[model samples]
Target: MSGLRQEIGQKAQAEGFSTPRFARLAHDLEQQARLRAFIAEGRHGDMAWMAETEERRGSPLSLWPEAKSAIVLAHSYGQEFDPLERLQDKQSGVIASYALNRDYHLLVKGKLKRLGQWLSHRAKTKVKVFLDTAPVMEKPLAQKAGLGWQGKHTNLVSRELGSWFFIGTIFTTAEIEPDAPEQDHCGSCRACLDICPTAAFPAPYQLDARRCISYLTIEHEGHIAPEFRVAMGNRIYGCDDCLAVCPWNKFAAAASDARLLARDALTSPPLSQLLELDDAAFRALFTASPVKRSGRNRFLRNVLIAAGNSGDTALVPKVTALLSDPSPLVRAMAVWALSRLTAKPEFAALRNDLMNSEADMDVRREWETA
Candidate 1:
């Protein structure tokens, strides 16, 4: 039993994953109850999938009945540079550090799948692997496996890896020893809470996804509400403010995985350049990246808000061009951006010129408000 755990850890580390930890399958519902409360309070916002898969997320066995043990691994995506530093360049759109290069889903999950295959063949037992794509409540399972503790921001924080690692798991019928769960280390630190541009945290450990810029920019499909636009600043993809400020990050090393390093273009993409990304260009820019999954219209909608916050009058013409964008999500945000970057009279003139011709009620509302 102990040999199997050692073997899996060695194999996972060889595959660019952290040394694996083990946890036994159980009928635990502690995390599930918290999930229920989060959904009941509508803290998940438009992430309806969390509610849709509520029962299935109860435990690993919910997804696989035959499982008796679990193997957990962490893959670090820590950056060499401070991601917050990029936020200072207001003229450029800041993408979350995680999405600055290759998508983790493909890289992390692919490595885990190979590890699972090896374990199944060696032990002659069935195995199933999972990452963020599954409803397995990975953070809780990771904590149970002694991988890390869920910190004040509701993200798992490892003493060795800080807050910059992705969790992966393999569930198998073979019984293995479960490691002692990691204990909470967050004391009086309020850096992650106070640094939020939109005040996403309602209480110490409670997050309101509605106010989260990451949710607003990535998951929320509709037009960004006016209040969060300015706070969003130049973040066009996702916000890393809370994650970057964690003091635990001092222990995190720069990612050794060459595949996960930040791409030159995505590090601090200029708002002017990003705004010019039409559908085809957008696809080309983010073909293998996670940003593509959010789709062009939604990404542009965020960029326009960043443009609004930029105060870079140089972007005014580019922002004006998006007024005629086919997507109302883009056009509405364009109206909002123009109001900020251009003079009031110029914005009023553009509205007077474009309002009557605008058909979408949402775009018309933007014009009426501008």
Candidate 2:
């Protein structure tokens, strides 16, 4: 152990990162293979960026050959309320626990930058920090650093902290003894697999991003597949069905960062009000939040899908108003919503009103089916 390592660990603990560990920059060939198979199978779906940076993602050495060690940090953003509590209200959409407040990338990056400066000052080494934005495979790196094992759900999980945390990485040209990776304790429990609304897990320890609602509403930019809409229920934002079902979360701590606490309006907002938000209002509501990254059109597209699944005829008028939205993707989803809302009689009237006049071919086809 080096004097620099001990000093940095004390500083990190004082800075609020729950646990910090150091790991040498070595590629885990097995995890890299799994990530390759995942992307090659097209499980990443429309998230092309995952494939674009394969080299850096597979090995930290490729990201920066001079990097001698990777410092992995974990921050628990646990919930005060049972996140599942919001799901019972069918009329109110459930936003994922992690996204209920401010974006983790921004929050964690700011802290990691401070940590990096501390490293440079103490060890006199060049350092680089990363959140989720970078190509580095953060979860695998964290596990290698003894932060925790990647749970069967493929998110890093710990016996002490469970799965309610975000992982950050700091790469530097400093030698630090690595910790042994933690063993997986997921065992025979399949709570996360059975709980998915879209059957996104082809098997345990894997995810088909196409069927994951988090991908559908966030990474996916176009109209959501019709068959999955009903299964989506009222989750207008990212889904947390898998994470909420994990029994390990019982050990998770309440978030100490005030910025991560769920805003009351977002906890279980009415589907109608969410659908009614215009672009300007949506920007105002989610300005610094992760939800804002999806942009208004993509979010409204999700809200329309939720409206269609809502089984509330009252929302049909609101959905109808978005048929002429500037984005064709939003317009197409509005057509799907109208189709789901109205029966044969009203459907016929809406079809006549929209079919031929719709400029988008996809919207026209959706209206024809409606």
Candidate 3:
């Protein structure tokens, strides 16, 4: 079993994955209870899918009845520099490091499929692959597989790889030896908790996704809540403040995968230029990138919030032009941006002129409120 684990690890490294670990296909009773509790408390916010697929997500056994063992893989996407440093540049939009390149779903899934095939051939057994796209509760499974422990931020953090990595899973019917699960090493450290701009962590190891900027800019649709908008700063795509402050990251290596490298354009995009993106321009710029999943409307909505928080009057013109954007979500955020950049009297004048013709209830309300 030990020799088999070493062989699998070597194979994973040669195939471009960080390392592979194995976990038995048993019910994770504690994880199941925590997940059910999270749904009951509504901490998942608008991610109702967590509740919808609770049974399947609760255990690897339930997700795949034939699965006897789970192989977990990690791929490092560590940033060469601190991602949080961009917050000082209000004129720039801060995209999460992960989204700054090609989507990991494509890259990680490809690796997982290849590895699964190799393992199937070697062990002469059926195997299945999964990435973030599946409801597999990857974090807990990764911990169970001895890859890493879940840090206080509710993200997998490794002593060797830190928190900047993507997870991939391969479930096989072949009975494989399982590694001992990792224990929490966070101790008294609260770096991830204190670094959060939105105080999204209710307690260590628990997150309120509702207040999380990543959820707001990505999964969340429509107008962002007023309280979170300003705290969002210029983080237009996703937030990484918590991940950046983890002390364990000092030992991490730079991302080896060229496909996961941050594109220069997305590293710190100019808010002024981002605000100008129409649907077609947005699609072109973000094609194959994770940001495209937000769509032009939601993406622009996030950019407008950043513009409003930018405190740069120079962006007033660009934001004003979006007052009549086809997407009501964009127009509403544009009103908020204009309100921040324009004087009350001027903003009132613009709102009065725009309100009469606006039929969207949400946009009209933004005008009335602004």
Candidate 4:
């Protein structure tokens, strides 16, 4: 059985997972307190689920007493193509590297399930797999399992793989030996903190999700705050400035998974085409991809912000067409984009429409300076 555990690790390596480790299911009160403090401070933003299962997230044993061991896995998804290169084009929206290909949750979960099934067949014990879907604190579990240490950015960073890997876990009744916990290697490195465009990191090892571009553009819905929009640059979907600026990523490998590799359309998408995506078109464009979860209305809302920041008059017509969108959110952003594109004359021209328009107060505010 022990030899089989080693075989599993070898198999994981063969499958392109950078590192794999086993961790005993146990409580970590100190880590739990940190999570509580983060939630107490309202750092989670609209992600209510993070606070819902406090107990389960605090301890792996509490979630499943029968699970004696956790198999932690890390897969590198970074591409050889520099993610930061997209930022060079002021007119193109920068989608995060993780979302450039297929949804990672599905891809990693499928891999975990395959591994778990193999372990169950060999050990004749119950095995349950997770890929960032459960109440389990995956990063902490991975850290405790000796996969890597959580860096200043609060992401697990390994010496070899850097922080460009996705984590997966498998809980099993089999009593596999545990690995020693990894220690932090970030010695006086504030590169990640200094690189944030929105200052999302309030302190080292802590993230205020509300200010995070990834959170705002993807998880967040409705109107975006006035302050962060311009700073958002052309990152319409998710921001990678923090991830791209990390010095450790030089060691990160290009994705071995074909599904995780960057697709042609998303590699460096034109901002104009993104702004023109209607509901059906958006759905079809990102059908199986992670981007579809944001929906067309919110996505177009982001595009409007990007268009506004673009300072390119070429996107004016695309922004103008969305003013009459059924979704008030989209309409409001359209007004904001048009305002950013044109000056007082454009505002005066659209003054009567702005006055009579049923736009939100926030959107109307953009017109005040138009």
lDDT of candidates 1 onward, in order: 0.89, 0.85, 0.90, 0.85
Candidate 3 Cα outliers beyond 4 Å, as residue runs: none
Candidate 1 global Cα RMSD? 0.9
Each candidate's TM vs. the true structure? 0.98, 0.96, 0.98, 0.96
**Residue 23 error for model 1, in Å?**
1.0
For candidate 1, the per-residue lDDT at 344 reads 81
Clashing pairs in 2: none
TM-score of candidate 3 against the unseen true structure: 0.98
Q: What local lDDT score does residue 132 receive in model 1, on the 0 to 100 scale? A: 89
Pairs that collide in candidate 1 are none
Per-residue lDDT tens digits of candidate 4, residues 1-370? 5797788888788767765898998888988999899999999998988899877888888889888999999987887688878887988888888888899988888788888888888889899988887888989989888988888888788877877888988999999888999888889998989989899999999999999999999989868988998889888888777767777777788889888988999888888999878889998889788999999988988888999899899988888888778888888888878878887677578866654675567556655644
Candidate 3 lDDT tens digits, 106-222: 887887888888888988889999988788999999999899999999999998888899999999998998989998889999999998999999999999999999999999976
Clashes in model 3: which pairs?
A: none
Best by TM-score, which number? 1
Residue 118 lDDT, candidate 4, scale 0-100:
84
Cα error of candidate 1 at position 315, Å = 1.0
lDDT score for residue 286 of model 1: 98
Positional deviation of residue 122's Cα in model 4 after best superposition, in angstroms: 0.3
lDDT of 2 by residue, 238-337 (tens): 8877887888878888778878888887888898888878889999889789999999999988888888777788888778888878888888888887
